[model samples]
Target: MDNYTPPFNQSLPQTAEGVPNKNSLSSYLPIRTKGNDFDFDAVIGLVLRGLLRKKVEGYSYEQFVADCQSAFEEKLGEEEFWQVLKEMYFENKDIFTVSPELLLFRAQKGEFAAGDSRVASMFTNLLQNMRVEEFEAKLNFVEREMLSTLREKMKPDSSLQASEKPYLPYLSKAFREDLKFLASRPKYLLSEIESFLSFYGFTYTVQLSLALVDWRSGQEPVAKPLYFIMDHERASNERTHIKNHGYKLFNESATRLFPMLTMLEILQPSSSEKGAIKVPLWEISKGIQESKLTHLKERLEKFARAFKSQRNLDTVLDESDAALDWLGNVMKLALAQFSIGERFNINKRYVLEVEKYLASHFIQNRGRSGRVLVLNQDYIILLTNLVVGEKDKLRFYELITAFEQRGIFVDKQTEQELIKFYERIGNVERMSDSGDAVYVRKTI
Candidate 1:
């Protein structure tokens, strides 16, 4: 069997002249994992990530069920898998959504019942409501229009109006069903805010496994943006009661992550407007590692306040284009902060003398951790390759003076790190005279 390819590697469709077609995919088109396949985990991860990635806005019962069947191959019965996922949704409610409109667990035969999809029934009712005489023409039109309109409006903190909205073919039909599913459980919606906060809190840990690795590898705290965008959304959503659901979301759950800028005031959700449901923004409300690492928490807050690149923060809507634009802005905004240190929290004092020089040339803010001298070889080579062989002309006290004056201190203990690095590369000499020293860089 061919090695199963990931969605990231798919090529865009090209015309004869070799330019990609304007209409080609941005995100790779998803396919059912039912055909002869081998990489079960890849399929399962991507499918689940895709489904849960957008679960907050709700998604299609049909597409989600298809993804579930594709996840286990055809080995699991379609009805059986759907039942499994519907229950999993309750266990991990934040990540999954089950349309209460469907009586998903009705008894059919011994444990496997082919339950009817009420979501499908909603479309059927819409077809009957439209009073179309022919099935084929209207069926295709309604389904396509419904999906297109739904994707367009489901972006962050945005909603569609059924009564006042302009006439779009599937506008009424699509939301009419969703509003029903959302209004399905008022008792659950009005359940303790603690239950909601617990779910919201788990969101932090969900992405932290990957996030902490990146953080250690000199990457930004990965969950920062995820939590930020969630905050931006929840603020807009908490203003009013859910549409037709008669309850406002407990908006306090958004404070789960540290603010990007320490001094900037956090924007509150809009004031309540009658008949409106504030968008549920499952955001974090506190510092990421506050309880255990108060020191780390203080440092992160300092970085947040110190890094002021994103002065004009923008709204992150649901489109891929909008999302990409926001990501670009975010990365660039954090560049000054990033350039200071590829890594953070330098616990040891004194680095290689060479490293100290390399850092001075590269960073603007001087890195945030325990004296973040340029410890990376890639950066060292890029900035100071020429200076490596010229230690002979350099004076020892002058080197010490330069370090002290510039605030780049390296204690005697750190001398071994420099000696080891230079010895590994070879061709360097160290000599001492009357409490001073001269060293020469090897000729490359």
Candidate 2:
């Protein structure tokens, strides 16, 4: 996981030219014109007021529109009202809570860049009731009851509410000594009282369950709520950073690789391992964002021309020939998402034991009958075979574990698909009960 922080922290301790103002709508709202003077500023001001006054709760889109209309005393048309609200939302986003319906709509419709959930959560958290706050409040209520009971020297009795009844004896010498010890600790030592009260988040349940926490074993129950909020905020900020600038480097490389790949996809429509597997050109395209489609047009043309002009006919292209296929698709996706650099390097050698497989009467299965899901599953098996050598064999569990360790998975549904492929090509055989074995064509 990335350390949760803003992505663009290169700027000095000052605001740059176009960043949003944390407290004001000046940066977000458009300036009003002279002729129509619709008093948007006044409307927005009142809307902000209503939102802050009812900040802890939310409104449906209809309720929100009606409330704004009632509070501002304006009868703008349907189009005009929504337009006004949209402008206000942009300008006062930091302070104002947009309806969840609108947030979800934007996120779903791709209006939100990368459609990241954390960005939605950051906005939505403001409008929703937080559970942790209630948990913290319950702990505080319990502590107060316990303290008051002790001060009054009340005896433990079934008649009192459980919260009011102190668990520790009020008049005991041990209780006084414990209080004295707590008082003697440092100024920030009030958290020590968590021990006196069983402050854990879980506890003894009655007929009706009450809020409880295991306070004695962990951090103070009262403080857990604050930690939860802070942790959530950190994660959200980290995701926002990733979504905003996560693709900058790959986009640059995609620019470089696009034209070269375009030529390669046409020239070689199947996997590079000499007819091992055939995948169509479009699956590779679906693996990336639509934004990547037109990103490096100008630069890629120059590289594409050079790549074609200087090409050698006998030169092996490796699996990148399937740039629009699964082999090319997975590699491109990894580079686009996981790798970061300016240069686009296109060199792959996926088929290692080509002669051995071919000699054993196993030609690459060029019959295309699967999607990206199946292609990758078979890819894991083939790559595993290369590492372990076809002469030796690994157990099914060991093979799957190896795949997982290398960030690949041979899922349960894909098991039969792999079995079928191996059955078609006899060198890779299932050892009946052993689930392990290798055979050279007919000689088992």
The count of residue-pair clashes in candidate 1 stands at 20
Which candidate ranks first by lDDT, i.e. highest? Answer: 2
| lDDT values for all models | 0.25, 0.26
Error of 2 at 173 (Å): 64
- Cα displacement (angstroms), candidate 2, residue 373, comes to 2.2
Q: Tens digit of lDDT per residue, candidate 2, span 1-444? A: 123211111211121222222211110011111111222222222222222222212223344444444433444446565556446543454212212112211221222232122222211222221111111112233233322322232122211111111111111222233333333331212232222211110111000011111211212111111111110111223333222221221122223223233332332222334323212123223222122333223222323333323331122223322222332332233234222322222211101121121111211222231101112323333344433433366565666454333223333434444555556665455556344553222111
What does the lDDT come to for candidate 2? Answer: 0.26
lDDT score of residue 63 within candidate 2: 46
Cα lDDT of model 1 by residue, 1-444, tens digit: 133221111221122232211111101011111121113222222212222222123444445444444544444546665466455543344221222112111111132211112112212222222221111212243233333333342323212111111111232332233223223332232222122222211222223211322321222332222111111122223322221111111111111111111111121122243542111111111212112322332333322332332332232322222222222232333322222332111111112221221123322222221112122333222112222223343444454343232222333433344444544566335674322554434322
| TM-score of every prediction relative to native | 0.17, 0.18
How many pairs of residues collide in each model? 20, 12
